[model samples]
Target: MSKTFKFFIPCDKAHIVCDKAQYREASLWEKAKLITHLAFCKICRKYTKNNTKLTDKIKESQIQCLDRKDKAAMKKDFEKALKDYSN
Candidate 1:
């Protein structure tokens, strides 16, 4: 189609753009296209809403993670258990 009509995007592409937007990686043009798509696509709008909620929840949870030293210790223990089991 023509460049003027390029703003209209499909659901799959809109989903990708939505994800990119969530991660602050979408370009201005892509965000515009996604907005245009979301304007008419109810499914995509819901998807965007749910995705936003999930991101918000994750941020609010403030989850902690294991450091590299802790991970290495766990790996070593797991390997020892495996070796013992295989004997």
Candidate 2:
């Protein structure tokens, strides 16, 4: 059963932050209080340890080219084929 955590603080309210440790351990009150703490403190929010948010910029790079040895072998094969064709 999901436990409902209730914390009403002035300046910021109704902030819902899921606490993985408490939620995994089935502690609803702790999760609710964490949500409450996060609502007021940005520093605590920044330092919160969890894996949900991946804020890092990810880039997809692809390299399409032959390696040095393969390139050399291809060049040699092309040269041999050209020589055979000319003869």
Candidate 3:
């Protein structure tokens, strides 16, 4: 692809670029192309909008998770319980 026309990517390629942009992994040129594609494609625009909303929701959710230490403790307890039951 020519350097000047690199920003005219297809819908599928645009979606991939959009995802990379969401993850902060896309290059500047890729982001430009995705934006351009979104401008002309309503479906891709909607897709991008929904994707952004989903990412925001995930970030804003008050979900908690176990740390590595907690996970290790639970694993040890489970293993000990299994061993005791087997005996």
Candidate 4:
């Protein structure tokens, strides 16, 4: 494993690169190395596949979240209840 070919990245580093690649934050060289590593590493390949599937499922889910106004109202109500209970 020569430094020039950058052979055999560790599993920890590969997982980091995998995450970065998923988020489109990995550099070209890093992505290339990760892909190459995946070729021979079954665990990493499955991890990448599962991660991608999870991301896709999350994206497909149409779950709605409360906006700031609703959050603020809830906070206010909680605070009022706490104050009343304290007194």
Candidate 5:
């Protein structure tokens, strides 16, 4: 492929671009290449659609994680239980 006409990217690269776009990390050129790839690749288009839907659902869920202190306490408890079980 010519250097100037390198807009169409492979599926793997398109997937990475899609993920980066979801996280607002992909550059404008990468986005453009991904869009061009999606224009003709049905499979990639579906993959991008599913990825977008998954991202949207995650944002809507607003999931939370345990803080560092809570995680440390949980790990300590688990270790204590394992020690007891081994004895």
Candidate 6:
């Protein structure tokens, strides 16, 4: 929620990397954030692989995640977590 890190994380598409070289295999920070987000945000976890398209399961899960309400807020949290991971 800090203005400094606001742009780093979009409301969605955080799984989409802005720079592939920035994290490579991902640092511990990245991994930890990803893991934590995975626990809460199932859609991001299902679509963790950035190079590939979202899987059917992921799409379905994302739809389900959307259905649960808080769709926008969850996505924002997921993006912020991804930004924390990447940064």
Per-residue lDDT for 15-87 in model 2, tens only?
A: 2234344236525665667667777777556655332343221213344679999999999999999999999
Each candidate structure's TM-score, on Cα atoms with residue i matched to residue i, is 0.93, 0.32, 0.72, 0.77, 0.93, 0.32
Q: Across residues 2-84, which tens digit of lDDT does each residue of candidate 4 receive?
A: 78567668788999999999899999989888988999899999999999999899889977999999999999999999999
- Ranked by lDDT, the better of candidates 3 and 6 is 3
The per-candidate count of clashes, in order, stands at 0, 0, 0, 0, 0, 0
lDDT tens digits, residue span 5-86, model 3: 7658999998899899999999998898888888889999999999999999999997799999999999999999999999
What TM-score does candidate 1 reach?
Answer: 0.93
**Positional deviation of 40 in candidate 6, in angstroms?**
0.3
lDDT of 1: 0.96
Error of 4 at 62 (Å): 2.2
| TM-score of candidate 5 against the unseen true structure | 0.93
Give me the overall lDDT of model 5: 0.93
lDDT per residue for candidate 1 within 1-87, as digits (tens), equals: 798788799999999999999999999999999999999999999999999999999999999999999999999999999999999
Residue pairs in collision within model 1: none
lDDT of 6 by residue, 1-87 (tens): 685453333315346431221336555555445555556665665556442443445656756324545887898899999999999
User: Against the true structure, what is every candidate's RMSD?
Assistant: 1.0, 14.8, 2.7, 2.3, 1.1, 20.1
By lDDT, the better pick of 2 and 4 is 4
The list of candidate 3 runs beyond 4 A from truth reads 1-5, 75-87
- lDDT over C-alpha atoms for residue 6 of model 6: 36
Worst 10 residues of 5 by lDDT: 1-10
Q: How does candidate 6 score on lDDT?
A: 0.53
**Any runs in candidate 5 off by more than 4 Å, and if so which?**
none
The per-model lDDT (C-alpha) reads: 0.96, 0.54, 0.91, 0.90, 0.93, 0.53
Highest lDDT against the true fold, candidate: 1
